[model samples]
Target: MKSTVEQLSPTRVRLSVEVPFDELEPDFDRAYKQLAQQINIPGFRRGKAPAKLIEARVGRDAVLSQVVNDALPGKYSEAVTEGGVKALGQPEIDVTKLEYGETFEFTAEVDVRPEIALPAYGDVAVTVDALTVTDEDVEEQLKGLRERFGTLKGVERAVENGDFVTIDLSATVNGEDVEDAKTTGLSHEVGNGQLIDGLDEALVGVKSGETKEFTTTLLAGADAGQEAVVSVTVGSVKERELPEVDDEFAQLASEFDTVDELKADLRERVEQSKKMNQASEIRDNVLEKLLELTEIPVPEKVVQAQADEQIHEVVHQLNHDDDLLAKALEAQGTTREEFESQARESAEKQVRVQLLLDAIADAEDVSVDQGELQEHILFQAQRYGMNPGEFIQQVQQANQLPSLFQEVRRGKGLANVVLEAEVTDSDGNAVDTKAIFEPEGDEADDAEADAAAESDADAESK
Candidate 1:
């Protein structure tokens, strides 16, 4: 096999590969044998057909088709490996020659990781938020967890914010009864912001069996931005009662023997989590600052692709947030198209950062181990409430396995590079980052375990 690459663009490559007949003969022969065993021919039992006779009977085209399918992937991959190309996605292969006795020739056009030269990556002054998980943070987290495990105690008074209300509701668009618009026994928490807007506000000060009508935009489909009159009848209202934050409560919630011990443990966990969030934020700021110092030509195609992703994500996040989306557009001094363009710009910045990191990874030989890859997949799967195996399969089916590895390598490489950087906080103070850099342990591991269980549950649900 022989291979060569032509530079089409900084991010794109055209690879010309040729596999000689000698190298591909074994595959062709194997394909022929496999076909012979399954194919029927007169005057011979299955698997007893002569090779040349079978070729004559079935035609070389049939054999070659099977051979081509089996041979192309390995050959293309081999060429890529031998050429040392770090490609981003799947290749588009064109077979130029593949006759029985002829050498195989093909070309694959693909996106390759762009190379970015390192700017002054050493000592930079950027403020890292100091780890300070307040009592409030711990209390808030505890409250959230308790609410999940909390019992509902019925109320006699009117509905109030923080009270759960079960209601029967219906909507009509311009007085055409939307036959599909009805739900009963719907449990809504006042001010929790799920369901329709103006709903919780309407529910406020309303008691059981009271009907109230309000106008709010439909939160789905083409009618999403259009207003409709909603009729809601409060069936019942209940107040949530949380378990006391005392030693006895701790004993019920966990293995902690005393309330003080539980409180201390909770505080420690919150502090650790806050520091992790802080470190992630620091990395973002550092990368932003570093990007400011680096310059590279931005491909229009790359920018457009990045822009589409951003626009999609932005639309998804804002799909339900009318006020926020409108305010964001106003703040950015742009329309939806303009905001999408800005999103594209943000995406380009990320691409630039990745390019810079890729070059560094190459120079420093950064690589992600199988274990690290598994860890990343597990973490991401858990984030999406998916199973690790399912997530891995999804990535593979999308032909993004290599991209996933590249992402992991990029992250690890950037982390390693920052370690070598002369970094200081925003106040120009040097950071003693050891504590912040340490991994958040066991519970995170347990979260990954939960992810495995969640994956099973997801599969069962599906």
Candidate 2:
């Protein structure tokens, strides 16, 4: 088979394939034999029909059609390979010419993965959050530790900060008891300012069995937004008794002897966490900067598909919000169209970023460590609350391990670039390496935080 190709676009190509008569001969013979075996001719035994007789009955066209069907796939693949097609999806094929004892030719077009030209991806400087963990951070973690083992003692007085209150809440929207409305024995920490506004204020000065009414936006349930009147009667209130920050408390809370020792250990941990986070942030910034400097072309189909995925995610979240329709219209400027457009933009960015990153990965010979892959798989299984063995089996069964490994390696590659960069704070102060090496709370999703990052990058690139 001989071939020629045309570059329609960075992400698209047109391949012209020509399979010579010599290559078509074997398929012709196979087609004749298969047809002769399947058809019934009186006084003829199976496999006993001659090629010439089969051809006479079926005609040249029929035999050639079968031969064409069998031969096209291999010839098409060969043409694509020889033509250097970096395909994204299945090809669109059109048979231009097909005749016995003549060259068979066809035209194929497809969406291809575009080549990328990165600009200063390595050693790119960026400003990121400082890893100067204060004494307040340590105190906060200590308080959290104390609360974990703290006993809830019934309080005879009004609800206060650090007190857990049990209450029944009812809400109405424009004086209507909406659908999916219900009550629960909800435990709330007074002054948390998380659940709903005015909740802490309503709980204040209230004893057991005392009812209070306050206005707040609904966090959940049917009346999610639009000023709703909430009626709550406190059943009980308990004050949390935290352990003292001492030698004994330190041993119980952590593997340390004294409170000072514990603080020292925690400081080291905090520093490590800060470093990891800074490293991740700087890498992300590098990508952002690279996107700003590079030129990466995005294919339309890829953008559309990505937009659909984003819209689907938004719509799913919308179902859980009561005033979601209004909120979306107000925020996005349209009910669905605007959101879809934004999604398309996001998709384009993602496709371009993936292209560039893949190019970088190729250039640097980036690869995943086997031990790390196993460890990451096990870690994910635990996170999703699944057994490691079962998770590994499922991941393999689904054929998603290769992609997952690629993500891990991509992160590592980004990390390598970040380490070499001259990162600083907003004030242009040089960032400290010891401080930056601390773990940034559980490695947040770069994991998920910047799903739209590439989209912005795509725009900047364009």
Candidate 3:
């Protein structure tokens, strides 16, 4: 077998391959064996007929066709490997020549990984938002904790903001009842704005058994974007009574014995949360900077394929109802054209990011060990709310293990870039990015546990 490559473009290639007849003996043998099992030769048992006999029965053209079909994939893969072509997606193969004893020739056109000139990692810098946790932030956290422990008491008065209410809601568009928009005895919180547009305002000040009517545009269903007259009948109103912020209340709510101690812990937790948010901002800003500095040309075919897949998924979620898609887009103030345009743009960006990170991973010789891969799989399973074993089996069945492996490698690549780049807060203070992106091995875990135990001992001693 001999192969050569033609550069179709930076992101694509055409491979010309020629395999001599002598090199295809294995393929011919397999093809003949397969045909022998299916063909009935007078003196031979099933799968025991001679190749020449089978060919005589089925014709040489039939045998050659089977051989060509069976040989193409392996031959194409060999050509790609020999040519060192990093093929991206499926290849389009065209058989150019197939002689009786001379040679079999074909050409494959495929999308290849483009050559990317990586930017200097040391020169990359990004400024993220400063980590700031104020008293109000701690108070907000405390308020959430209090809300979780609050008691709901039935109120005899009108519904007010922050009150929970049980109500029956029915909507009609132009006097025709909207079946999808009607529900009975739904519990909602006033001022939460989780349900319909004007539901919160309509619920406020409505006493039990009082019905309020409001006009709002339906966001989904058949009448989406059309104004609907909604009738809401309040069944009951209840207010949450929070316990006082005292020592006793602290003991009741947490292991802490005093409100001051609870506030201190809340403040520390809020600070940690703010730091995490800062780390997230740094990751985004760093990626944005890298994209700005680099010029990565994405393949149009790959982008189109991804965009089509995304559009298909969106339609699938909508139950393939074109009208529902249109109406939903209308309610969101977007048209089908705009939605497609946005999807294409998103797909292009995603492809660019994947290609760029993959190149980085290759350049840095980034590798994902079994442990890291397993950890990533577990994380993904938790995210998708699937059992680990089930998710693994499903991904394996779909042949998506390589894609997941690539994802892990790309993450490690990006983390390497982040570690090399300079990151600072908005206040011009250098951020401790290593702490955020660095792997916490067993040593780090042991250190953390020891520190925690020491802190607990100190608290007890005090």
Candidate 4:
């Protein structure tokens, strides 16, 4: 067998392969056996017929067709390996020749990964927000903590913003009652704006036992996407009573015994949170800088496929109804054309990032150990609300391990870039990014636990 590759473009290639008849013996044998089991020949048991007789019964062309179909994948893979083609997606193959005893030939056109010229990571620099925690920040954190411990007390006044109210709701779409939208005794905050449009406005200044009517579009149910007149009957109104920020309150809300100690801890927590945000900004800006500096040609097919997938997910959520999807876009103040354009842009950016990071991983010779892979698996399982065992099984069944492995490799590659790049706060102070990106004591312990859980998950799956 011989294969030669022709570069069609920077991101695509065509491979032509030729194989002599002698190399097809194994494929012919398997095809004959499979065909024998499907056909009935007199005086012969099932799958016991000779190749000559099977060929005579089904025609030689039929046998050769089956052999070619069975052998194409292996032959294509071998040609790809021999030609050193970094194929991205499935190939379009065309059989050119299939002689009786001479040769079989075919050509495959596929998208290929483009060669990348990587820039020096040390030369890349980005600026992020400074990690600053002020008195106002600490007080905001303390206020949130106090709210968590706040008590609700019955109030004898009109419902106000931030007040909790128990209300019964009924709705009608086009003068017809929407049964699915009717509910009794639902608790909602006056200004939360979580339930429906115009609800918060109508609830404000309403007293207990008062009923207010408002118009809102029903987002779900049989009458979804239709404007409905909703009636909200306020059953009771209550105000949240927050305790004073004193030493006694500190003991009740946290392990700290004094208000001063609690405020100090809150300040530290706020600073830590800001550090995380700064780290994320650094990572994103570094990637953006690299993308701007480099020229990476992405496969148009892969980008289109990803865009189609994004659109499919949105359509799927709308129950595959095109009208519902259009309505949803309208509700969001966007057109289908605009949404598609955004999807394509997002998809192209994602593909470019993945390809660029993959190139970086290759250049750095980054490798993912079993523990790291297992840790990622555990994290993804928790994200999807699945046990590790079930998640692993689903991943294996779908042949998605390679994709997950690539994701981890890209992450590590980006981390390497972030480590080498110069990152500074907006105040021009050099930031110690390693403290945010690198695993610390707690993270290391979490990795160990993830490994143990992976062992358990493997056992459960088996």
C-alpha RMSD by candidate, in order: 7.4, 5.8, 6.6, 4.8
Give the per-residue Cα lDDT of candidate 4 at 418.
Answer: 81
lDDT of 1 by residue, 306-362 (tens): 767767776678665766676556544557667666676676766666676567677
TM-score, cand. 3 vs. native: 0.92
lDDT by residue (149-208, candidate 4, tens digit) is 999999999989999999999999889999988899999988877888899999998999
Model 1 ranges off by over 4 Å: 31-70, 95-104, 123-125, 128-158, 221-225, 238-270, 290-358, 367-408, 422-429, 438-462
**Residue lDDT tens for model 2, 349-457:** 7776777666767766876667656656755687679988898889999998986676566555554445556778766788753344333653443332222222223
Question: Relative to the unseen true structure, what is the C-alpha lDDT of residue 205 in candidate 3, on a scale of 0 to 100?
Answer: 86
TM-score of 1: 0.69
Q: Extract clashing residue pairs from model 4.
A: none
TM-score of each: 0.69, 0.78, 0.92, 0.92
What residue runs in model 3 are displaced by over 4 Å at the alpha carbon?
439-462
Ten residues in a row with the worst lDDT in model 1? 453-462
Query: Candidate 2 vs. truth: CA RMSD?
Result: 5.8
Report every candidate's CA lDDT. Answer: 0.73, 0.72, 0.83, 0.85
Predicted structure 4: clash tally: 0
